[model samples]
Target: MPLSVDRLKTLLQDDIKDLTKLSEILNKERTALKERSNTAIQTLASEKSTCIKSIEYRAKEKAKMFVDAGYQIKKGEFEKAIAEIQDPSLQALWRKVNIGLRFCQDQNTINGKVVSHSLKRVNKLMDIVRGQHNKPNLYGSSGKENSFGGLNSIAKA
Candidate 1:
């Protein structure tokens, strides 16, 4: 026997409720992922800035030494000063600066890709929920016959 209108309406209501719940869950997951991505980006930016400041400080120190030594500083002198700085701490700092720069670049690229992917997925899932919510009356004379057209209309609206 064919289902009554009330029964069909009840079933559709249940489906809508389930879909709404799923959409909420997906939204929450997307928000959490975005927060994590933002944190990672911020940490990388902080590390990169610290490394840049160290490099600038090292350059300034070398410049000061050249000026104080009563010698017209040449490019080679600057290079030699950097090379001759024998403090293990400074050497490690320089290495860390370079490593941080490379790491920041890599991390930014990866984070951008991940964010793009996440946004796309979120948009797709949202489209699905919206289509379900805006669906036309299937049995109505004015209802759209094509389900795909209904989805397109929802996307446009």
Candidate 2:
């Protein structure tokens, strides 16, 4: 039996709502990252996870709908299935969902980059504090390779 158009529309509408919430969460997460607010970031992460779960559930429901309708869904081909349905309204809803998902993905990517850069800086600072520089030891003005106890060593002394 083919999936009802009304049912598909509901799923798509739910997806749009979730995607919009996800996009907002991602933007807030970006701000949290910028402000280095761990509390806000953690809260947003939890909300994002919930939103993502809802989106994934709806996506699975959509795929199941297609399968029930005798359509094989391939990766990146959900839109194709929508096209095959021949329903203009469904197609439009799918487009909105697709665009919203893309926006969320881009925002997530940006957040990831911010996290990566921050981690790198933190690691570099830790290395400096530990005197664990990867650079080769250079000779000092006295012709001796510069060597000094790291902060950790001094603390242990």
The segments of candidate 2 whose C-alpha lies over 4 angstroms from its true place after superposition are 134-157
Candidate 2 lDDT by residue in tens digits, 29-110: 9999999999999999999999999999988888888888877777756667677789998889988988999999999999
Candidate 1 C-alpha lDDT tens digits along 69-148: 54457756533543565545444544544454455446556556777877767866997977855444343466634233
Clashes of each: 0, 0
TM-score of each: 0.33, 0.82
Q: Which candidate is the best by lDDT?
A: 2
Best by TM-score: 2
As a whole number from 0 to 100, the lDDT of residue 75 in candidate 2 is 76
Give the residue spans of candidate 1 off by over 4 A: 1-81, 84-89, 130-157
Give all candidate RMSDs, comma-separated: 26.6, 9.2
